[model samples]
Structure formats: C-alpha cells, structure tokens
Target: MTTLETPVPAGHRSLRQRAGNAGRRTTSDKVFNAVLTIAMVIAMVPLFVIIGYVTYRGIGVIGWDFFTLEEPPYRRAGGGYVAGFFGTLYIMGLAILMAVPLGIATAIYVVEYGQGKLAMAIRFFSDVMTGIPSIFVGLFVYGLMVSGWISVGFGTFVAAVAIAIIMLPIVTRSAEEMLKLVPDEWRNASYGLGAGKAQTILKTVLPAAAPGLITGSMLAIARGIGETAPLILTALGSVFIVTTLQGDPQAAVPLQIYNGARQPFEEGLNRAFGGALSLFVLVLIMVVAARIIGARANKRK
Candidate 1:
C-alpha cells in the first residue's frame, strides 16, 4: 500500500494568514476609552447643572423649620412645607401599595408562566404603556373620575390609581429583568428537590432578585413624588393636609411647587425654589438609600 501525503487546504492557510494579519493590525484601546469618558461626562453635565442650580437657589430657604412648619399663607411669608411633605408621603405610600404587588405578580406571570399569544400581546402593550406620556395618563384619569361617567368619586384614591398606572409597567419590566437574571441552576436545583412552583419562586427566585425590586421601587417612589400635572388634575392640590383617602383636594410637594412658582408674589417664588430644593434633596436621599440597599443585598449574596 502506498502512503499518500494529505494536502493542507488553501482555505485553511488563507484563514490563518488573515488571522495573523488581523492580529498585527492593532490600535490602542485608549481612543475608545477616551470616547467613553467624554460621553459619560457629557451625559452627566446637564444633571449636575440642574441639581447645582436648584441647590444654589433653594439651600438658603431649606431649614429644619422647613420640615415642621405648615405652608405659609402668603405663599412665601409664613411657614414651610410640613403639610405638603406628609401629603406626598401618604399619596406615594398608597400608590406603592396599589402598584407593587400587582406589578410584581404581573412580572412573574409574564416571565415564568405565560408562553402564548396572550403573553406576547401583554408584553407589547406593556412596552407601549411604559412609553406613554404622563400627561395622557392624567387626562385619562381626569376623564374617568374628574369629569367622565364616574365623576362622582375623584380624590386621592383616584390620583393613586393614576400614579399606579404610571408606575406599574416600570416596576414590572425591571422586576422581570431581575428575575430573569436568577440562574437556571437555582430553579433546577429547587426542582431537583421536588419543590413546587410557589415554593421555588418564594424561596429561591425572589430573594435573589430583591435588590433590583427595591431599586425599581425607589425609582417609582421618586417618579411619583415629583409628579405635578397628574396629581393636579386628579387630587387638585388642597391648601391644607388631607386626612382621608376620599378627602377633599390634597396638596403634594409638586403641586405646591407649581402653585407657589406661578404666583406673582416674591415670597411665593422663593417658596417655590425652596420646595424644589426640598424635592431634589428627597430624591437624592432615596437614590442613596437604594444604592445602599443594593450594595448590602449584593454583599449578602
């Protein structure tokens, strides 16, 4: 038997040559790094400017008394934003109560259970809803409760509902992404131990995803707190603190800011600046809290 020598294919040699050529055609990664740094700075510049402006204008007015005093009658002459502060907390707490469970549950179903046309449609609509303008949400709620067929019962509850609608899709999408990040091995291990769906989700998936959920919730709270137009249409900005869910018009920080800012009085404008500063501080605090919570959770993990 004659031994035949195998030929090295031209294609293989070409590929090797190309790979070598590509390896030699290197550029310094510094250009990319420079572009990334510049992009980040550009993005952050506007945010810093706004926060700096608000702090500069409002810091003189923000004080310990700002938290304890009531809204000044002169809009700039008397007390602080104590009532507006409590009202904001109340409305946002109620909105969270209305939004979290429903949002998380919807997220779970979409992520783990739904697999057919209905899931696709739900997801498509969720994307659309998440991008819809807040003004439109305000208009829809206003129509339903303020002036539409159900005109008889609009108040804080109505405002909460509107905010819930605004916040739900955000919470759901974030939670779904977080839950999806839980490794399949975790779920598989639970299944190996004969765990039921509910037990697996409760014990394995949710704890792993807690950080993201908390962060999303904080964002929701921040978003709801600064909202003015929606609450203005639905809650109508009461002069005094509201006691009941169905109580008369309720004032919130955002609405108070709008009211004070629009008035002709110099005191009112100062109060508006002060209110904006307070809001900025509150948002910053919440963001810090979220970061802390996320860091702790990650450390535990």
Candidate 2:
C-alpha cells in the first residue's frame, strides 16, 4: 500500500510567519484598555461619593461618647451607639462561632473527602446556599428559631444565626479554594514521611492554607456587619441600650440608620450619617486587619 503524503503550502507557512512576526498591541488593545479603565472608575465613583459624603456630614459627631451612648427619642439629647455597637459585637461573635466550624468542616469534606454522588450533592447544596438571600435566611430563622421553641419572635440571637447562615457559604467556598491551592507535592512529601491523610491535611495542608482561609473569614465577617435585611427581620429594632442578647431586642447600626434617616429631626439625620461613616470605618479596619494578619502568617512561614 502506498502512503499518501500531504505537502505544506507556502501560503500557510507565510501566514504563520506573519503571525509570529506581529509586533506590539495595536489600536484595538489601547481602545479596550481605555474602556476598561473608564468602566472601573465609573463602578467605583458611587462608593467613593457615599463614603465621602457620609464622612463630611458625620465626622464631627463621631467620638467615644457617640459609640457609648443610646439612641433616645430625643435625638441629640442622647449620645452614641453603645447598645448598637455592643449588639453588633455580640451578634458578630455568635455568627463567627456558628459559621467557622461548619464552614471549615464543609470545605474540608468538599476538598479532601468528596467523592461520587455525595460530593456532587454537597457541591450543589453549597452553591444553592451561597445564592440564598439574607432576608430568606432571616425568615427561616424566624420560623425555626423564633416561632418554634424560643418564641422570642425577633432578637439578637436569632439575628446572629441569620447572619451565620449568610456567612457560612462564603467562608466555606473561600476555604475550599484556599485548601485546593495547597500543593500536591507537599502532601506527597508529608505522606512520604509516614504521615496519614488526616495528619498531612491537619499539619501540612492547613497551615499552608491558613492565610487564605482567614482572609475569607474576614470577608464573611465584613459582609455580616453591614447586612441590614436579615437583622431587620430577625432582630427587629430597639432604641434602648441592650446589655444582654437573650432578654432585650437589639438594634444594629444599619437598623439605626434606616430608622433615623426617615425621621424629620435634624439630629436623627446627623446620627444616621455618623452611623454610616462609623460602619464604613469598621469594615475598613476589618479588611486592613485581615491583610495584616494574612501577611504576618505568610511571613511566619
């Protein structure tokens, strides 16, 4: 049998040569870059404007007293967000407690132990959970936690649980991605040293992935802090200082802004602006702290 050989064409060879000989980015690339730059600036302008306006309007009211006082009906007669601040802290503490373990554990299973139909199901549920609205989470907690046994309707604890649900999927997805970034060579090396699967994962993999995991956790916390819809449904609203999570209704900074901004009082408007500015600062501090911690952890290695 004769073998048929195909000869390469000069046109194709010249086309390839010309393609390889092409120089720098043409006009199209520069135009694309210009458009992208404009798009990014446009996307960022509203955020900057909001922060700037709030700071300009509220900086004078921001103080230690502003953080320590209650929101009395008399508006400026009372001081800061002592109850709101403490309530935020309390709710966030509970949310972290609930979200971290569950999120990390789920991430571990998805990354390490996941297989077959079980893995598929877990991934599907996780994706669904991530898309779920915060308001829906609040309603769910209201049904199970509020209407069922606790019968407290709306309170700080319920609000915390709602926030936990919102944060759980974010932390889990972040952790899973972080864990996946761990090098397989490192894992193999650990195994070569007689480390079992669990041991390799706990000692070698986890430490390497800690920075990403913590960064994810911080994002989750930041998201939880600014959430308004969930807290509105689960925590309701309270003007007085709330010392405990179980007994009294607790107001969040977002809730305070919502309630205060609608009133005709000038002081209420000022307080709302101040609260918005304070929340922005708090979120900013958290993001910065996360970056610092992540950097330190990386340096320690």
Clashes of each: 1, 1
Q: What's the lDDT of the predicted structure labeled candidate 2?
A: 0.85
lDDT of 2 by residue, 1-301 (tens): 9999576775666433455325455666888999999999999999899888999988878988888778777356447777778778888999999998899989999898987788788778778998988889887888787777667767788898999999998998889998998989999999999999999999999989989899989989998999988888788878776766764678788888888889988888888888999999999998998889878876875
Residue 166 accuracy (lDDT) in model 2: 92
Q: Where in model 2 is the C-alpha error above 4 Å?
A: 1-25, 291-301
Clashes in model 2: which pairs?
Answer: 66-80
Least well predicted 10-residue stretch by lDDT in candidate 1? 14-23
Candidate 1, residue 156: lDDT: 79
TM-score of each: 0.86, 0.87
- How would you encode candidate 1's per-residue C-alpha lDDT over 142-250 as one tens digit per residue? 9988888788455778888889889888888888888888899999999999999999999999988989898987887777778888888888886677878864787
Question: Positional deviation of 169 in candidate 2, in angstroms?
Answer: 0.1
N/CA/C clash count, model 2: 1
lDDT of each: 0.82, 0.85
Query: lDDT winner among the candidates?
Result: 2
